[model samples]
Target: MKLKLKPAIARRPRAMMGKLASAVRSKIEMEKIRRRGGPARIRKGPPEALLGLRRFVANPRQFGGFVSGPALAATITREIDPAAGPVLELGPGTGVFTRALLARGVPEHNLILVEADPMLAARLRLAFPQALVLACKAGSATPEMLGGLRPAAVVSGLPLLNFPGREVERILAAAFSFCTADAAIYQFTYGPKCPVREEIMARMELSAQRTARVWRNVPPASVYRITRD
Candidate 1:
């Protein structure tokens, strides 16, 4: 006797199996790198893309469907001054922006990366051994995490639109707490406007300006520069 399966159910297993195969391949590649290694050299393309996609499927609200492209990363970090001070990066998924920051002359040790995903956080540590990687949510960021260094600017990759207003306020408030007087927080959103709402900005005495729109991004995104009013 054979059991019949619905199309939806049959399709789910195939998708899961495909993801599993991808995970297996990623693991094999990691193992190869580990064996051949001095420092763990995880290359910067397909593996990270696969991991980002898996995390996106698991939690769309927290992880967007695609990683930030190089153009998007470069655009967002364009205004950042590497000589100013420490750079606080939230949701540094696949460290695309982190790499861009480095390219812009920000030293590895001057970066403080806050990533919520454990797997991604571990990879970040491996990928950037000199930079500080904290595996915690954006709202949980604090001065203590910075270890006495204030951030000159914040380059956030968080999906703030998916969060509630209060949480958004909290995250921004925390971000500003340890920042310099001239600091600005740079955020990108797939939406038509700023991801951080107006009320939250007003309440915090913060102001936002749309800096750039990158059509090259996967879904096309707008960059915003927010600073204290």
Candidate 2:
């Protein structure tokens, strides 16, 4: 099915494609510089940070600031197995967590990035051409979106507390549907508790436990892995 975003958020016209092209070229150049053992110049903001900041400006209701740090991103994704079918990432933002998943041995083709912000989705497609990029709200997700592919693990960078309880439940239900019986949902939250509330987890027949805490983050964050058991 074709995914659509609110027209106001996807303000990118054909003219904006040029901006995407420039960003892609800059990313490639940075990679090449790293490979050559030369230091690349720093940008005002990292791609993921910039994407998050931009999206937040567009709609703070949809996004919190990007993942506080790359370490946090890598930490949340630590337990996922490479062979666990395709990995479905919720609110991948600018691919920060996506990059960590790839570095952890998850293949590019195994990734399915769901980004609500249309501009970020467009940028994600240009940045990670091999992965599936869907521009739709995570709460609107359906099992049909997976096309028979089951997920080994679902990693989320979504800020659930900013959303209503019902919306949170819907997003969790959708993510868990595509998971194997043993699959897990790894989610991070800035708040003290699990990102998805306990009652919602109970309603979905899922359980969660705190896995790690990133104390160095600005507001600190914790990771939780939800399971069917």
Candidate 3:
């Protein structure tokens, strides 16, 4: 008998067809990129020098600035517990650390990225649309910047050593004030030792210990965990 067609059975085939279409589309896109050059070929540089006059005006010692090595970036983000609340990333240059943080299970919505360079900030906003990206000086950021949100961890890519002594102190204080009591600050530096000098550490009522050394990175670098005693 010409009997019964169920609605569920009709829907199953359509759903399966949709899945097949998606898989085919993804494969085509991958092949196109591979045939070109690679994913890197599709990427573009910032529209302008993000760091601005700071790039030419500051001396090497005064800048203490280095984009974080990929290995070191992985280490810092790995230490972040996924269960922790939102994370605050300072001076997220070109979003190296920002990408690592996402790979480490921190949701994009839970990240607040503060970048001082206008060009870099714009790039970050485009690259990480899910993150709460802001173009502002780290030292000048207030708790309200996050819309009254409190971060569980602060991961900074800023060149702390290059900052003047007072500026460094102010940045640290502002970071600590916004962070939860148990929150930790992850910072990487190529300096001889921790970026936060002994005096600044004491004044901030914080202490830092080296967490990892990434020798494969350019000029090498170390990750430090600063926390309140």
Q: How well is each residue in 83-109 modelled by candidate 1, as lDDT tens digits?
A: 999999999877888999999999999
Candidate 1 regions with alpha-carbon error over 4 angstroms: 1-39
Q: Per-residue lDDT of 4-122 in model 2, one digit per residue for the tens?
A: 97786677675598898999999999889889675543232565577577778888878874745877977988998897679999998777788889999999988988999887788
TM-scores of the candidates in the order shown: 0.84, 0.78, 0.74
**Cα displacement (Å) at residue 68, model 1:** 1.6
> Mind sharing the TM-score for model 1?
0.84
- On lDDT, the stronger of 1 and 3 is 1
Write down the RMSD of all candidates, one decimal each: 6.8, 13.0, 15.4
Q: How does each model score on lDDT? A: 0.89, 0.82, 0.79
Highest TM-score against the true fold, candidate: 1
The candidate 2 region of ten consecutive residues with least summed lDDT is: 39-48
User: Which one is best on lDDT?
Assistant: 1
